[model samples]
Target: MDIYDEIEIEDFTFDPELKIFQHPCPCGDRFAITLDDLVDGEDIAVCPSCSLMVKVIFEPEDLEEFLED
Candidate 1:
């Protein structure tokens, strides 16, 4: 399905402990994606409780920090 919205990667809150980026979804669930997912070149954050998806605007170069050494 097409993304419901576009959220700048900077808009995401990075949880150092959880190692994931999260943003509140309109559906009352959180739209989330892990660092691993970022490193793997994934830019879609999906709300676990709904079919809604958001496109994460990110640069490949900015993903270096999330990549495994």
Candidate 2:
């Protein structure tokens, strides 16, 4: 399937402790992707409880700030 939405990295909640980014999904679950994944050029976050997924719109530099957190 295609992405459910295109969300900015700024709109997502970054968990410094977990080093993951999260956003609410319409399926009552959260979309999640790890910092490592982003660093590796990954941009898709998927919701574990459903088939929906979101495309995380960001550049490599966008992850620089989160690197310290």
Candidate 3:
């Protein structure tokens, strides 16, 4: 359970289809978090294959555009 790093939201690539934010993990997998997760006030992105997690830096208000249906 290692806390990897704190990364800016801008550093993540948002997938409109998946509606998630993605960043490449050093372990070859990806750190991902969904827009719902963000809207729910979550700030951590985790790698599905590993224990690495990163803190996401973003304002809840900043996620308005992504939350739109």
Candidate 4:
């Protein structure tokens, strides 16, 4: 699937409570993806209010710090 944009994981805001990464979407909503999804090798962050999606750029090892103990 073609994505609307390519964003680095560091550019996203990580919500500890929800355990999700979020970034602003042009459609006035946020593009979101969960840590579980990333850990499982998923990279697409989709906007809840639109069809737009952004590919999250990250390394598998970088996700280790976010893991629940």
Q: Pick the candidate with the highest lDDT.
A: 2
Residue-level lDDT tens digits of model 2 in 8-54: 99999999999999999998889999999999998999999999999
Per-residue lDDT for 5-61 in model 3, tens only? 999999999999989999999999999999989988888999999899999999978
Task: Please tell me which predicted candidate would have the highest TM-score against the true structure.
Answer: 2
Candidate 4, lDDT over the whole model: 0.93
Q: Using Cα atoms with residue i matched to residue i, what is each candidate's TM-score against the true structure? A: 0.85, 0.94, 0.89, 0.93
- Candidate 4 on 1-69: residue-level lDDT in tens? 879999999999989889999999998999999999999999999998989999999999888888853
Point out where model 3 deviates above 4 Å: none
Off by over 4 Å in 4: none
As for TM-score, the candidate ahead, 2 or 3, is: 2
Task: Point out the higher-scoring one by lDDT: 2 or 4.
Answer: 2
Report lDDT per candidate. Answer: 0.88, 0.94, 0.91, 0.93
Q: Could you tell which candidate, 3 or 4, scores higher by lDDT?
A: 4
TM-score of 1: 0.85
Tens digits of lDDT, candidate 1, 1-69: 689999998899988778899999999999999988987888899999999999999997876765543
lDDT at position 54, candidate 3: 96
Predictions: Cα RMSD each: 2.1, 0.9, 1.3, 1.2
Clashing pairs in 4: none
